[model samples]
Target: MPPVTLKDVAQHAGVSHQTVSNVLNGHPHIRPTTKERVLASIAALDYYPNQAAKALREARTTTVCCVFYGHNPEDISDPYRNLVQSAFIAEAQAHGYSITTAFVNDDADLTQLRQRFLQREFGGAVIVGTVLTPSQVHTFQAWEMPVVLFDHALPSTTNVTADYPEGMAALVQHHVLQGRRRLALIIPEQDLGSTSIRRREGFLQTCARAGVEGAVYDGTWSYDAGYRAMQALWAGESRPDAVLGGNDRIGAGALRAAHDLGLRVPEDVSISGFDDFEFAQFTTPSLTTVHIPHGDMARQAVRGLISLIDGTESESRVFPLSLVVRESA
Candidate 1:
């Protein structure tokens, strides 16, 4: 069958195409009875609005693009990425908007991505998990497109981020309350950006207040990195009684390392991580970590982007983080 169009609904409702368009666009000029008739015809025919044509008529794209750097097949396979992306997709669909995803790799030129935005005419953009270099951020600013950043922060751009500092602080205080004195933190390399830095600051501040010396091991944000960091901690002159993994993946690795080293979790050394990924619960000892609420963050990002697209004003909002206590800690 041919694609259903406004003409079909108009003919079925015995009204002009303009009248059908008016009703669909919520124009007040259309009579109540005519509106009902047109709506009934639309339902009977299973007519759907042509989003592309609607956008063209309105002079807006009505589509949004989500860009992530360092995200690939491997990254998407991770539970954390799936959670965040699923939330974003559901939220975007609720607003009658479409989402397109793009990946930026180390050797790939960003100009290609920029060209895509121009070709597709995306109404707005949301960038997730990408650390924007200063120059790159300047380029985005110059584009003057409505943009929102998630899971990271950038200068002069609207962003929705988890309360990393407070989350880490709560994790640290929890261990201290559990009577664990010496604390160690396994963090990703410094250049990964503000999220890690804020988490580290929170950990350090909480440890200082408790009068405990905090040791920090800098490494990548991966299971292998977490395993190596734990090994190095054990080899050190003094071992921390508790360890904080930057995220759930790191925390899971730390738990495995503890088991391999003949250390009983919470008995020999307690471990906690951030971002309660799905695997956190299935670990040998369930992970005690901070839950960043990916769904809420995605909802907020969508709300903010809708406001931006609709020319509405919005204030910057930060979602609160909660500590999930489980067996590992």
Candidate 2:
């Protein structure tokens, strides 16, 4: 039997040989429709690139790492994290790359990660879930290994993040337009990532500009946290006219707390949240929140890393955040 070649795949896909080559090399300029046709044709024809010849030409691995901080595989449950990881895996696979997931939480793990990086076991890496310190990021930059920082920004690394500050500002403006003063925020307990910082800054700055009194309650990124924070906020001398949750989980928790306290949401007090998680709409009276494009972010991050690995310059991008209006707010 004859081995399938790039020419065979190109003929099968009805594209030029160079197009097939571009697809195999993960060229960023190819149209998605054309790329899809080429990929499908390759799979249909069971065409596999000549590994040795390819290595002789590029001499680089096709394995990319998705590095997460503060959590291991068995304990991972955040919806956003799960979505982005899945997207990254799919996108990497589409680009003829394999993805390996790793967890780094402390100095020991960081040391191990650096060692693996120095060994050139990964072609590139995507930093997700937690923001690394500036020095740590600089170390990666010094290694000349392509690194994409998701949801965070470092001076020397490629960063991809949603416009969280803009979303927060818009949400606050919406609350003000609704005639809701005395705004309150339910912030997550830990500054888990850069998203938290952006949201906090956006809320504070927007509230100040709007001349709306605001209060903040620290909590975790969970329903229980939202509930507890809401309880604390309401137990004060006066309750907030409008409450903004850090995320849907916290918002859902806050909604339950409000219901338990006999307060009517959007009537007694309006409530809003972020992330637009799956359950955001199902909660009683639903939830109004910001929608972050998880899939898009993941795709861009993977592509950016791939471009970097190919010795092509990849620029940082910030995805615009959009508000999803529902019943809660």
Candidate 3:
């Protein structure tokens, strides 16, 4: 079927397209009955305004796409993503641009995304929160529009990311200060993505310099995986004295697993996590974590992506990470 246009909406509402536009623009002169008719027609037609023209006739209203990715639908709904998204939207609107959000979970979803982008009215897109696998990188390279990868670094693309290794170094040294001689990192399986590699590099390098043992454990980025990894580590004869969770969710799970095993945190094993998620402070012991400045990241990334869209080059940005020490570790 052909794409629905403003004319379709006007026809469905039995009004002129000008009347539909007036109602959409909130002209205030239109009667309540006319506005309701237009809205109902829009819903019935499944009509989406040309995003660049959505509710604004001004030339400043550039529509930018924000694409979020995850391993699954649930992961896409993660709080971390929400943090970034809220910030991203606010920052975009600050510069007079309209924002639309999209999700890409796996390669299969790429087809739908491609269809939208092919006919898209947007100028540029900001792809954030996704693990940039090689295939993903390759696929993104094919896109003709400007894109900025947020929190995930891609040598082939402009990136606005965090200093993960630096963050991990701070975390590791904190553990070492408490006389922790052995450390282990529980994170998602290794990938070429900057988050995974930089985190490991920081943990291992810091541990080696501190003359402490640091091991890496692989798992899904989920609470269940963290729980199982912790259980397996405890089952071993020589488990690390300090456990570092890749993110707060994993750390929360590890904390629970330790409690269930009748082990006292910090007494048996000290734990730390990343991403100072809201739940971090509310955890039983209150999780110690590294804070990713989601707002700052969003601000920087949106500015950078928009710059690139305006025929200017934007260098990648890396924001420093901070550690929030709490009772957890």
The model with the greater lDDT, 2 or 3, is 2
The estimated TM-scores of all candidates read 0.78, 0.79, 0.77
Which 10 consecutive residues of model 3 have the lowest summed lDDT? 52-61
Maximum-TM-score candidate:
2
Candidate 3 at residue 32, lDDT? Answer: 73
1-329 per-residue lDDT for model 1 (tens digits):
67788898899999999998887666878787887788778767856566464344346676887777667755655776778777878888898988877676642234445544544557677777646776776665565566778877766667888888899989999999989999999987575677888888999999999998898889777888788889889988999999999888888888888889999999989999899887888898999999988888887887787778787765566789999999999
Candidate numbers sorted by TM-score from highest down: 2, 1, 3
Report, for every candidate in turn, its global Cα lDDT versus the true structure. 0.79, 0.84, 0.81
Clashing pairs in 2: 189-219
Task: Locate the minimum summed-lDDT window of 10 residues in model 2.
Answer: 50-59
The predicted structure with the larger lDDT, 1 or 2, is: 2
Clashing pairs in 3: none
